[model samples]
Target: MRGTIVTLGGGGFSMADTGITPIDELLLGLTGKRRPRVCFVGTASGDAASYRERFFDAFGARAHASALVLFGQATHAFTAPQILLEQDLVYVGGGSTANLLALWRLHGVPALLEQAAAGGTVLAGISAGMNCWYEGSSTDSFAPLAPLRDGLGWLPGSACPHYFAEPGRAERFGEWVADGTLPPGYAADDGVALVWRDGALAEVVSERPGGQAFAVTAAGETPLEVRLLARF
Candidate 1:
């Protein structure tokens, strides 16, 4: 069976509104196997330690059947192919996207993730986690410090999280799109998520009332426009 991918905006844990229900539905849709195996990667924030607790708090007793695995260090060879082989979900955590990608690639985790996903492992991530799938991104959180780092490219374009919070971020995103430095993509606000399946956007969901998504593309030299996606 084909699996599902859930990418979250930054501040997933603190966000008052997290569209985790849709993610749950997607996971249930993927498999009916009891006690699904789940793995987490790249949490410099120390959030992975409480993943199961937080999930149970948010989802209640229904989360009991899920098994959570965490890979917290910056670079470590994930030696459990048995776990990878049997995992139903592989989740990446939020942190420095550059560092996460570097560590993941250095440890050859990305290729392993691809293999797992191709083999029907449900893939999900939040914040920097989500950013890992895109080719590149405009993130004040990490990009300014290390511009040369490449993302995992699980998807075909760029990803911009915290899309509306930062000043002039929209303008910067447009510039990158126009210059062909980044591909056409979606910008996600907190509490909102864009779901991509089989290399295509399947749907978007929002738990917060004010979040909006932007579709950006190059219009002309030194010009770009940000338009709201009607679907969201």
Candidate 2:
């Protein structure tokens, strides 16, 4: 079983549009299914109703859009595995990365998602969602930007999202890698994504002009040329 992981530094269906952005359009196309059923897991935001609404509003017109709310109230009936594995795409919403990981473990979401990925579901997400796929990441989920060592490890190495959106992200991440706190990994600017097929980076896509991705290691950060796509 092979799979693809789309890691976004920022930007996606949640960005709000009468139509989807190019980056999101690319993600939908990866499913290889017409009108694919896409499930939004909003555990990071504590199952925020507004976030769920955003998902439906963005994707409902094009796909069978739905959400899995693990807090406050239940919105979907199927079990985690059922919902995860049966879908064409499973998108994770961003919020608190630490909390997201903790909650996911509590509900066995990690295992279910791994199963979904192994079965060839297109797994994608932004921010914390992006951070979760790597062995570790540089995140602000704990207040300040810090090294988050615990991750699902679906992709090799580490990751850092919002590489350019946040000030000092590049500097701090470099320092972490230099000091051996975080492993060398990839990073992306807002509105950009790193696409991995079978655990190897296959492409870089961006919705905004000048949006970028990078390969950051102990030596230094090197910019990855990305193909920019026009907005819908």
Candidate 3:
């Protein structure tokens, strides 16, 4: 299906201390290709070279992995947007959400991403990466946990990541949704991901066995069923 986006709470292949996780396998499987072309967008982390290397190190063997650099090094002649449009999947790195949004717009990435999505390219990311796709999110991009309502809006409502790993995130997200600071939306624990397909919640998958995901509204929080990837 087109418009498939996987929003991970945290702990991606590069972010994790160990090897590839179930989340990684699950994402690659979505491409329905033997060796998918995956582009790592590290703009959120300011296009850090080490982060890019970590990405390739994690995925080099199984996929045609490449990183898109936006901090002055535009080595490829085709253009950054072209690089994204060509991928089977685009994985964004986590960092300051505010910076990510601004830079994406300037580079015309959001529009190209929409184009890529329309062509069946899957978009995925953790934390800030996840936060940027929704209408809004509770983020620490401002040096404090705050409400950021300016997002790509590819997916409706809001999103809250690191639900389990971050202390007080559950209460804060619930409060924001209830008090109208943010729209009703989904939340995910670290190592868990919410897969949105064709603009609706499609599946919830996790690397951790007991990891939780939630559907939070002005009314309250409802738990969503999570499928542990390792079991499958």
Candidate 4:
């Protein structure tokens, strides 16, 4: 089945107090449901209570929002995989990609996520969350913002989130792709979402002005057109 993935460099409810934004609005729209079942995967943030609160405050009033809290693997009626499968949309919160990867693997989440995507669940995230779907990405999970080459491989090539908002991200990602430490791939600036549909790039959208995107290769980097959301 055709599925969708929206990889945002940054922006969304995570950035604002009210958490309302065009990007998040678009996510809900993608689900094609009235008050779709939305799940917030905050594993990257260690299932922090504050982050969960923020997500609920932003989405609770609209969608059927819930946070799949995995901390300590607390006893619950449903397993992590089951909760993930039931969502119309899965929004991952940003945090340490390295830790997120490790924990997810331990809990058998990768396969379920793959299944969720194949089943037409709209998967989206920012920063570390965005980095999880690709084969590799530029990350701050380690010191010096290194290239993280081991990813889920759902999409081809590598990826780098927060390309403009963070210092040295562009430089390091460019270098890594050029030197073949990572494959030639895509990078998204703050407020930009590199959307992929059915395994190919569908469009590049931005929540604000001045946001850009790029296609990075060993030869060089090329600027990609970013469509500013009308509501923004």
Number of the top-ranking candidate, with lDDT as the measure: 3
* Deviating ranges (above 4 Å) for candidate 4: 73-79
Global local distance difference test of model 1: 0.59
Instruction: Give the per-residue lDDT of model 2 (tens digit) for 91-199.
Output: 9988888899998888888888888888888999999989998999998887889899998888988889889889989899999888889999999988999999998
Counting clashing residue pairs in each candidate, in order, gives 0, 0, 0, 1
TM-scores vs. true structure, each candidate: 0.72, 0.94, 0.94, 0.94
Candidate 3 C-alpha lDDT tens digits along 126-227: 999999999999898988788899998989899999997888788889999999999999999998999999998889988887889999999998999999
Task: Score each candidate by Cα lDDT.
Answer: 0.59, 0.86, 0.88, 0.87
TM-score: the better of candidates 1 and 2: 2
Clashing pairs for model 1 are none
Off by over 4 Å in 2: 17-19, 74-81
